[model samples]
Target: MRSDYLGFSCLLSAVILQATAVLAADDDVLKRGAYLMNGPVACGNCHTPVGPNGPDLSKELAGGTPFDFPEFMAFSANITPDPETGIGSWSDDQIARAIREGIRPDGTVIGPPMPIEFYRHLSDDDLKAIVAYLRHLAVVKNEVPRSTFNIPLPPNYGPPIVSQGSPSPDDKIAYGGYLVAISHCLECHTPRGSDGHLDMKRAGAGGNSFPGPWGVSVSRNITPDLEDGIGSWSDDEIKAAITTGVRKDGTHLMPPMAFGYYANITGGDLDAIVAYLRTLPPQKTTN
Candidate 1:
């Protein structure tokens, strides 16, 4: 009877310890998700509605931003966890697939400029973190209009992603490249050809023009060219530009860059980004 009691006590203690550890791990996951969502990921930049003054944070990720291009009129979807209107009904795997693969749970394809291509590179852990962050958002009831694309969207972005991983931060350049890819920086920076395809050969050449309420803002060359790119700018200057939207010349950059979201990037991540930028081959800005 004494031995059985001792065994039962030990089992109970072990179970409690396991549960505590699991809770702690979950807390860590939520913290990482919050950081990524509010920082480098910045889903709010697109999903959150913008008013005359700027983004309406009250609505948060409730969505309904309109992207009007010659090719399509896209309305960002409400990603809030509202069951009737948002992603409340979406399983974790469904949300992850929608983000990385651009396939909705109902078998519809999400269209540009959703940047699923870049998101496809997101690590499994990071993707899980993002989904968790999104799942916990305040449920906002918003009915977002579906997007219309004159140009045909492909059946799928590419072959279904099997598994994805991130480079260790110890590898500064590689990690920075991973950050940039997930952030989809080149999606706006790189110039598109006549076919509306990005010219990878001149990846950071940066002559894409964005027209909005703030007027037309041309993306500048981000390559290592002495005259045309950040080659002459110091590392701090580059970081400042990214975080503050202020150029090396002290001129303020225009909107759609999501400087507000970028400001949350950690110093180590910023260093890595600058390190990656330093590796790009110098290219003159495209016409």
Candidate 2:
């Protein structure tokens, strides 16, 4: 009887240790998710509704911002976990699928401006972390209107992803490219073809125009062209443009750039981004 009791105590202790480790891992995941979402990922830049003062934090991620384009009028969806109108009922898999694959549980394709093309490159681990962070958010009961697209959405973003992984941070250029992909930097900066699809050959040349309360803001050329791009700008200048929305000439950049969210990005990540930007082939803007 004494020996059996001792063994039971030992087993219980081991189980407790295992559980503690699992909890620690969970904490790390949540921290990473918070950093990405509030920082460079900046999902709220579009999803969160803006009032006179700016984004209303009380309704954070409740959604309702309208993206009125010539092709479609879309309202960002309430990503809060409210059961009645938000994503409260979505399973972990469902949320991941919606983000990375652009397909909802009901088999509907999410339309553009959502940037599913870039999100498809997100790693499995990061996707899991994002979903976990979302699941824990305070539920906000807000219903957003569906988007109407004059142009047809593709049958799917692409073949379903079986598995995905991110490049190691040690490889600065590769990892930076990965970061750029998930950030969808080129989605707005790159010029679109006559068909409205991005012209990959001229990626980062810029020329896209965005109109908002701030008036029309054109995405500048981000390529290495000294005459038309940031090739001559120092690394710090590039970083400033990203974090503070200030150009090399000291003029403040306009809205829809999400400089507020980018200001939170770590210095190391900023270095990676600048390094990657330096590698782009010299290309003049179409404009």
Query: By summed lDDT, which 10 consecutive residues of candidate 1 come out lowest?
Result: 51-60
> Candidate 2: what lDDT?
0.90
lDDT of 2 by residue, 1-287 (tens): 99999999999999999999999999999998888888878888998889899789888889989998999898999999998789898899999999999999999999978999999999999898888888888888887888899889998999999899999989999988888888889898899998889998888999998989999999999998999999999999999999999999999999898898899999999999888988888788768
C-alpha local distance difference test of each model: 0.91, 0.90
- Give the per-residue lDDT digits (tens) of candidate 1, residues 188-284: 8888888888887888899988888888899989998999899999999999999999999999999889898999999999999889989988899
* Cα RMSD for predicted model 2: 1.1
Model 1 per-residue lDDT at 26: 84
Off by over 4 Å in 1: none
Per-candidate total of colliding backbone pairs: 0, 0
**Cα-based RMSD of the predictions, in order?**
1.2, 1.1
Structure candidate 1, residue pairs in collision: none
